[model samples]
Target: MTIPEPGGPDALLWSEVPDPVPGPGEVVVDVRATAVNRADLLQRQGHYPPPPGAPAYPGLECSGMIGAIGPGVAGWEVGQEVCALLAGGGYAERVAVPAGQLLPVPAGVDLVDAAALPEVACTVWSNVVRLARLAEGETLLVHGGGSGIGTFAVQLGVALGATVVVTARAAKHERLRELGAAHTIDYREQDFLEEVRRVTDGRGADVVLDIMGASYLSRNVAALAADGRLVVIGMQGGRKGELDLGELLAKRGTLAATALRSRPTGQKAEIVRGVQEQVWPLVEAGRVRPVVDRRLPITEAAQAHRLVESSDHLGKVLLTLG
Candidate 1:
């Protein structure tokens, strides 16, 4: 992760940097695995920079065993297997993270697979369930149904009693349907807006989770029903575009964007706490678990980035400490 400033996949290299040690209110984890995110790729490409006071390393989430605790850190013990949200430093042999951001690995899943949960789950919870306020019996439209966030959104939306329609390419439709997407739109072959209209009986969607930013702005506003909400997380296509201001006002719609990696430590810890209270028990009881597509050694980071960037994998591609 220290290969070069604004590094690319080819630039991602393993270096023998000094192992992390805990600072006050922090704990150092002996990392078992770390998950790849688009943000990491951006950072490597010199497009994204870690927020102020964040670690210089490049990983947003990781699972590992506890190694040491610093002063004032309590309620966690050495050797505990956990997954944590990090501002950075996840792509290392040992990562020092704030104790409050850590969550215990669920009863049945391996520590490695658990690495996939924290980031996506936190994102979904903050957006779909929290900001958008999706309710049972509502219609939820999810763009990018094949992605880690999309898959999680599909299952969680359906399980919450909302009708879920997803936009994915044809090849991934069947699996997406199996994962609780009530309707699927092959975005390559069909128009997402047209499909959402058809699936919602022309009422449009009650909630739309969009990862395509400006590209979908005007169309997303058009696809929403009265009092609907549109949550934008990533703009894969482009960042600037026109919005249908008339449509937004006419439909009484809501628009919001959030990023997890760049949040303040207190805010991030609060999200973690909320997840533990509301989502962790469900995971513990087998209601849902992190979905993993593949795991590779940290030295093979470049290959993992290629897999994720290819958009072929269904869930998450993780990098383990070599």
Candidate 2:
């Protein structure tokens, strides 16, 4: 898919584009599926652009078979089933991916559904586990529990032995609990900060994985347990919010915000390796699995975007190729 001009979902044009050649340390994938992400929506609206040297198209992850391999890339062969975390260019029939970013499809995950794993797995693993060091017996608060990232974080936190609490719509509460959320707060009807306090008996969350950004900044800090860590990964709720440093200091809380697409290739490769080593086994063992709301043909990319924008989907909405 090519975007001649950035606008709405309709801006995505499934027009012809030149085939991508595999560069050194890269492999070309015959893309079978790609998952829609909030980053794709932001790029579609012209608010976010791919990093330098990335494809102009908008997709962050894809699953496929290796079609070609570039020089200096080893241990991977053509025709191997694989999925990749992409900086861009996944919204097409084929994409060239750095070899280090490719992962074998888990023993039981469907090829198409595997597309949902790379991005969410890498993001949650890197932010929550690697950076924040969410330990066993801690309390994890995940905002936007119905989102791809949100759902994955909830499950991963549970798998790591943490008490998972999420803020989502009432409609998604039951499903989230089924996914291992210990408590679910209906953000529309309940104040998450208050709920977190009540659920933890006023101790608050030990680690908060937030997506709402600036809008939740103050409350997120206030909801932190002593020595808590807040990792902000998105800005859906405005980009600017005032923080009460005094409160944060009193709580001895730490705040960190991160983005995946803009990370250097080496850093991304490291994250990919971490996911493969630490997370892939959980997936293969069925402790964690991809949650997909629905799959649509690539031609219905616009519809998929609209579905995601509407926040009606429970998990990821995937776009598939023939």
The numbered model that scores best in TM-score is: 2
What TM-score against the true fold does each predicted structure earn? 0.97, 0.99
List residue ranges in candidate 2 displaced over 4 A.
Answer: none
* Clash numbers, per candidate: 3, 0
RMSD of each: 1.2, 0.6
Maximum-lDDT candidate: 2
What is candidate 1's lDDT per residue for 75-187, written digit by digit as tens? Answer: 99999999999999888888899998999997888889999989988998888887898899999999998888888888878777899999988989998888888999998
| Cα lDDT of model 2 by residue, 1-322, tens digit | 8888989999999999999999999999999999999999999989999999999998999999999999999999999999999999999999999999999999999999999999999999999999999999999999999999999999999999999999999999999999999999999999999999999999999999999999999999999999999999999999999999999999989999999999999999999999999999999999999999999999999999999999989989999999
Q: lDDT per prediction?
A: 0.88, 0.96
RMSD of 2: 0.6
